[model samples]
Each structure stands twice: as C-alpha cells, then as structure tokens.
Target: MLKNKFFLIVAILLVFFVVYYTFFGGNTASVDGLEATINPATYGRQVVEKRTEKDQFLRTNAESPILDKASFRGLSYFAPDVSYRVVARLEPFADKTQKLVVSMSDGSEEVYEKFAHAVFSLHGEACRLLVVKLENTYSILFRDSTSGKETYGGGRYIELDPKQLTDNHAIIDFNTAYNPYCAYNPRYACPLPPTENKLPVAIKSGEKYIAHE
Candidate 1:
C-alpha cells in the first residue's frame, strides 16, 4: 500500500510540474518573444542588420563584381531614424497600362508599370512615390532633396509587402532605403527614379553614395 501511495504521489507531482512549465516556460524567453516582437526599434535594428549582412555578401560574392575588387571598409548609411517611418495611403494609378521609362546608368531604359502611388509626410512636408510591381513584391525608387548631398545621387529604393497593405494604407520606412548597385559599380545598370517620385524634403536616412575607388 505504501509503494502504491508513493507511486501516486510521484505521478501527481510530475503532472503538476509539466502543466506549470507548459504554461510558464515561454515567458522566460527574450523580450522579443513569439508575439510581442513588433516595434519601431526592432524594425530599425533589422534594417541595419540586414544591410550589414548584404554588404558582406556582396563584398565576397564572385558574381557581385562591384565590391569584389574594390577596397572598402563598408557601405555608408545615415543613423536609423524612426521619424522617417510613415504610414502612407496607397492610391492606385487609374490607368491600367500606365508605364514609366526609367533611365538606367548604362544609357538604357527599363519599362516599368506605375501600378500605385504612396503618399506620406516627412517633417510635416508632403511626399509621394511611385510604386512598381516586381515579381511578387511592390517597390519604390525615389529621390529626395538629400539625394545629391547626403544619399545616393541616383536615389534610394524600398520594397513593400503587398500583403501588409490594409485598407489602402501601408507602412513605408525610409530608414530602410538603400542605394543602387550602380552606385558601387558602373557595370551595374540601375534604374533611376522618375520625376514624380522626387521629394522636396531632405530624407537624412538610408544608404549614402559610395564613390568607386
């Protein structure tokens, strides 16, 4: 009888421990846990981290000739700013066949459909950008007043997730803006931003121009 009682006590204690751990163990995880991970700082860090990884990848890639032979420490970027992150209204261009001829550095033109426009504000100044569909994701290539002086002369690019657009509103984070490959190598023919995508305000965020050595 004592042996049976001891076995029952052990089984009861084991079940209670399992239940408590199953319900409470996940709380001990990092602050960036499974559900509460979305935040502005997290996004900013992710952008910088992704860019750093990309630069390293480009520097070592055999096919990426831009950084393979060029001696450079790393790509330049403005400090991540949450102010550059804005929620915009995604307005569709009425004309279904509206196409834009984006000039390439190689003196070539790439035809892109202007599917939509993202209208947002920066430092209280109104800004807009043309959106183009690239395969499965939407993208924007734009230039601001800071283009020549701070960012890449050819401007910067940002990709948007179509699935994230809710009720015609999308979050456009300019802090994640990046320069074109042509900025690093002339052999790369990158598409230039069209006239409509130019902003009057200086966007002091994103990748800067790196002169080729």
Candidate 2:
C-alpha cells in the first residue's frame, strides 16, 4: 500500500507539470503571438545597455522641475526631467547650419538662450525636429535620428512643457527617448519628427532593440 501511494503521488505531479507547460510554456503559438504583437525582429535589432542602480532609481523616482511660468510660442508649460548620453554625429545640415538654438535659465537670470546642435542619443534613434508655435504654447519637437539605418525610420518624440523653462539647464538624455508604437507595428499613425529637429549625432544610450531567438 505504501508503494502504491507513492507511485500515485508521482504520477499526479507529472500530470500537473505537463498541464502547466502546455498552457504557458515555450509553445510555438505563444511565442508567435508575442512576436505578432511587438515584432521581435525590430526588437532584436536594438541594443540596450544596463544602467547603474542609482541612475535607475533616480530616473524612476526623481521629482520633476517646477517652473514659475514658461511658455513656448504662447503655450503653457510644465517640465519633464530628462537624462541621456551623447552618441555620434550624422551628416551636417545644408547652408552651413551648425548648432541648434536652445533657451535655458541660469538661476540669476530670468531666461537665457543658447545653441546646442550637438544633440546626442541614448540609442540609435536620432533626434528629429518639429517645432510648432500654437496660440499660447510652443510644441517641443524631436525624432529618431537613426530611423532607416538602425532604428525605426518613422521616429519618436517627447513633449516639453514650456512653462518649465528656466535659466537653470535641464538634462536631455537620449536614453529615455523611445519609439512610438507604430515603429514596432504598422497599425498606428505616429507623427514623424520634422527635418529641422534632426540632430547630426548618434545617440547610443537608453532602451535597445528587443530581440528574441
């Protein structure tokens, strides 16, 4: 009787294992479904470097900067804290365009304008341009610098709150910038970064291409 009970228990455990694997294990259909949703090919092409625990913690928990009153093209503003690394450079723009004009606050002064054409990336996606001046606000623009070559050519962007602009400088990390959903799949219509926003540098930080074997 003791031997029979042991055998029964063993058989039951085996059955449970089989059921779990069949439902949620490495089934081909399940894997295919995941790929269909996010396009593993595009994901695999990306390369994401690991971040230090301190940097990760800061990125997730840092408090956003609060500005008294920032406006771009007459729009209200709110600033989002960005942090990224510089990458490489692309081709220069025509007409000997060298730098991009950036406005920052220097604490003592109310507003300070400077040029920073040397935009870097955390990943392959290069930054593109799309500056729009709406009623009371200005639309901050950017795009994937490596669209066709390394990343999605359609590109990605971040919206800046003009109200947060201060004399003090803000961190613009390319690693934090990401591609839109359309880059992974063709079911969405994402706005492409305009030509003016294109940075002539290669940003090699942030989330990399997702890959699956």
TM-score of each: 0.75, 0.34
Mind giving the per-residue lDDT tens digits that candidate 2 earns over 125-162?
Answer: 54533333334443334544455555545554543344
Give me the runs in candidate 2 sitting further than 4 Å from their true place.
1-141, 161-164, 167-169, 210-213
Residue 192 lDDT (model 1): 88
Q: Which candidate is the best by lDDT?
A: 1
Backbone collision tally, model 1: 0
lDDT tens digits by residue: candidate 1, 54-95: 778777778664654567567788888777767787789778
Residue 63 in candidate 2 has what lDDT? 34
